[model samples]
Target: MPISSVEKDLDALTMTIVAEFPVPVRRLWDAYADPRQIEKFWGPPGWPATFARHDMAPGGRSSYYMTGPGGERAGAYWEFLAVEPERSFEVLDGFAGPDGTPDPAMPTTRMTCTFEETGAGARVTTTTSFDSLDDLQKLLEMGMQEGMTAAMGQMDAVVADLASFAAGRAAELQILSDAQVRVSRVIRGPLRSVWDAHHDPALLRRWMLGPDGWTMPVCEVATKVGDSYRFEWEQEGGGGRFGFTGELLESLPPHRAVTTERMVGVEGPGTVNELTLTPVEGGTLLTVVITYPDPQTRDQVLATGMVDGQEMSYARLEAEVLTPA
Candidate 1:
């Protein structure tokens, strides 16, 4: 989607960005001024963020929300630079520790944004300057500046079709494979009810594969220390079913369950699965953690992904726990 005649411009001896958005300068200004709007679009594709403030005036500060791989939040702050209403602004962006204290080793950048009204719409020309050419060269080497540029591009498009962009990510990849499925759901039911449902083979059949077809080789253990089991799984497709042997190494009954599984197939070495159930205000929060030995296995597993096999197991757990009598 690169357009010719990109309206490229530069400032003397410094790196710069020049582009036009669909909206006017003032509208773009508001998007910068409003924290909520900033969160909608900003940063590179696949990278998520949040805006804590948009102090549009001088001496105002802003915070950014950053999430790591497992959805854990990492945040930081930036101090505002020159600010002129709806026209231009600048800022010194840095990496602050979780406590919001600036870490001096990570130098801040000076960013300048100028808005001009073009017939196409308002054009935004953002130029970022470092203290030295060496610094600028370093950032380019680190892929920092280009990342921000792509992020701005993503934001501009997001401003127009938010819902469509979201749907595109959530839509099924539409792949057909004889891969395994793991489904999971959290149920806010009583502990006793969930426990009873789990113990009953009839109720288990409703959510899990009935004992007739699948091997329930694992079961019958105290929900206490050193408890465990094994399972033989056959997928819907015929690529050769796999067997998994593991145990319930630890348990805080009705709270969390720790299980380690070893795969018996050419596909994997083995992986550990951890399930946590924390009682919430009304419902219990269920989490499934799968630690893959290598990135290759992770990628392979995702290629066959639908409802992940572990997630499916959690779904079965939820059904047994929450189904009403």
Candidate 2:
């Protein structure tokens, strides 16, 4: 068991759990920073988790759900209060509805996770403060301690497996739900550069082309929340022309962005794409949570080899735009 101690202070209305790992602090921190890695052990053994959004920055929010053995789900969310990279992070944790809204009936807690170097390796101290003694007792009765212990038990394997989530790997796709999917990649560039590459027309025209024979004829980028952008591509010999248009719904420069995307000439509901970028051990972790109109639409798009095209474009971005000549 990685958990060294679990302490509950009734007077302070807080519970503290300390877990030590046989790895460096950076390794332990990265395991939590990346949604792909953290989701592996965020839930207990039988109840696996899928994170739809995981933005590890102050004022950001993360929403995820755990699936039970019977296929039932329990959703939760974290509103980040502070983030000190590789050191500590604090969040307001609470229950969430299926739509990811906060459950007003459930009690919320303030939790802080601190990382430190230990003689053996590294240690993580997680302290959760409840609003009242009743809240703390209520959670304890709900098997909170047992759930956490079981979840942390699986971290040993995740932290040690570095190759799976290492840099230079191609983009990965995770189906978050019937209508949502998350595409993730570790781009070999700084966070700002990756963010800029998506916005600057010149930078985008250089690498947003998916295949070797394709050329981007139009590259209009949305600069603000209400701005709309369009992009069109064509084959080298002037055949196979297509395009996408979208309106920027939200923009948090260099960290996150949300946009509504649809085919330029298509006549149907569009998809909402939420993109988040975080600095990690190897490079910038880019995550895009896309919400399709429905399961059919989601399947249709994925069936078109969208992920493979995205991988090709990202690889090109690294080799052409981000990389030095």
Candidate 3:
């Protein structure tokens, strides 16, 4: 496969290499975001490269070296000038010594890498700017063209592996089924604190609101089996109010609970919501599993931005309830 093409403009004092990959932009971005992945394809096929230090952020520095056939190491360093996730970044590339220090005698190239999404997949354009024509020619004479071409050529195989791994990781995180929608979070506090945030009316009012400019005006929880609870959120500008009322079916303090939730003005029957908490090393792992009566209802709830709303609410709960308590 044609992976990369290099273009050199001596008069323009620039060298640009563009590569196309059949992978998601995020997977391609991981080639640079992860140092371990970069180490695998940073040099020509035979001269393997190893990174001593890699900090992928604006103003950060990365130091690495390539080992030759005779064990000769060619060290290089990059000073990151700017960084934008899944998009582009700028860096100053230069030769370095074994100690990871920049060598003043070597020419430095200003490099910019841009990642763009396309119909086919993702494309990356890396441009290197030289100070002068002589500087560009000097690097070319040092086998820069062959080195870069061979290095970037390895990206296709690397991206394929990364894409597969990313897909597997995403599948593990997604929680969607015919009858249920599940969400989980690790709250940065003890299990009891997280449980209290759900049962305590005052604490419940602080983080249960769905959207911005909404306040949980009324929150009541009986905290016992066969008991009922109700929560209402009123918009700030007198817009409107919405809430859910439920009956507790099972209660196991600070660990697990089962309840039923019915929207204030919804049409069909409510859903069964199961809440479980487990103690982790430093906090609590809270999981909420909601079983809908049908697939249509489950899809409707998902379409209403329920997942995003819950994520936002969980963030607030962590900051306000977990942190303060």
Candidate 4:
């Protein structure tokens, strides 16, 4: 109820984010109401929660199947608080089940997300509180800051694209001048299996975007640093115009892959992306890292439609690699 006063009233107050998702509190509240909405955006990026549950109340607990690339499941939970619908909900992690039962295996923290109705849209302020400085530091050290910031940017795009149970007219939205939106997926799959989906021309054609009616004629990958690859996609059949290309930055067999991508329409080769694959109990864990070499470019893309592409791409990758065939 007393927001700004949270600093004076609470012990060890922490500040993290303020995001405009282009949706009002009423509709944004709906996402919290329905379990399906939670299912859609629960994972970091490119990963889907295989098994998800939400009680949606003050005393409830939520769970999700953290399906990494190649189908490895890591479980996560959240304990809810202050359950006011469409207005606010606060949650903390590292708590035992409904009862006092304890589990020391997992690291935990607390989170508070408040929704406000603004003329601009629903401004969501999320605060991540830690039991100890160590917990907060660990999250930052593990790259949570950059990733969450990008995820919020991705959320704003989703809110913009949604058909108006909540919608902010494109014109009303202040254009992003410079902002970068990014997402990462930790994938665990067999090196050969992951490689096949990436290297096989036919398989690659199934996922990558196009201008429609595109065909892959030349898909070459070197799989090692300094190795160049060319991907040519065309619609006119013989001698067409569409094409995309990238050069290998570094490739670690069954371990990791990095590339610099260049497309036909874009300014130049942009994005130095890395995919690290780690072997898990029954599958391979693949982590995708996308970087914008220039800060200005990153900020510009974040302000523009870059996030839409990132979110859609992550969803597509989840479909292609994480799901069971």
Give me the runs in candidate 2 sitting further than 4 Å from their true place. none
TM-score for each model: 0.45, 0.98, 0.52, 0.43
Q: lDDT: which candidate is best?
A: 2
Residue 228, candidate 1: alpha-carbon lDDT: 57
In terms of TM-score, the best-performing candidate is 2
| Tens-digit lDDT string for candidate 1 (1-325) | 2111222223343666676667666666655654445665565666666543334445656656666567666556767767776688888877677655776776567778887788876777777677766666666787876666666776565445433222112212211112211222345565455554554544444554532244343344334556555444463454345555566665545544557677655454666654444332234433345556776665576667434543554455555546555
Per-residue accuracy of model 3 over 22-67 as CA lDDT, tens digit each = 8878778877755546767889988987654455666666767898
Q: Candidate 3 — which residues are off by over 4 angstroms?
A: 163-325
- Judge candidate 3 against the unseen true structure and give its global Cα lDDT, from 0 to 1: 0.76
278-302 per-residue lDDT for model 2 (tens digits): 9997889999999999999999999
Residue 211 C-alpha lDDT in model 2: 76
lDDT of each candidate versus the true structure:
0.54, 0.93, 0.76, 0.55
lDDT of 1: 0.54
TM-score of model number 3: 0.52
RMSD of each: 14.0, 1.0, 18.9, 15.8
Distance from true location, Cα of 207 in model 3, Å: 25
Instruction: Find the number of clashing residue pairs for candidate 2.
Output: 0
Residue 147 in candidate 4, Cα distance off native in Å = 3.6
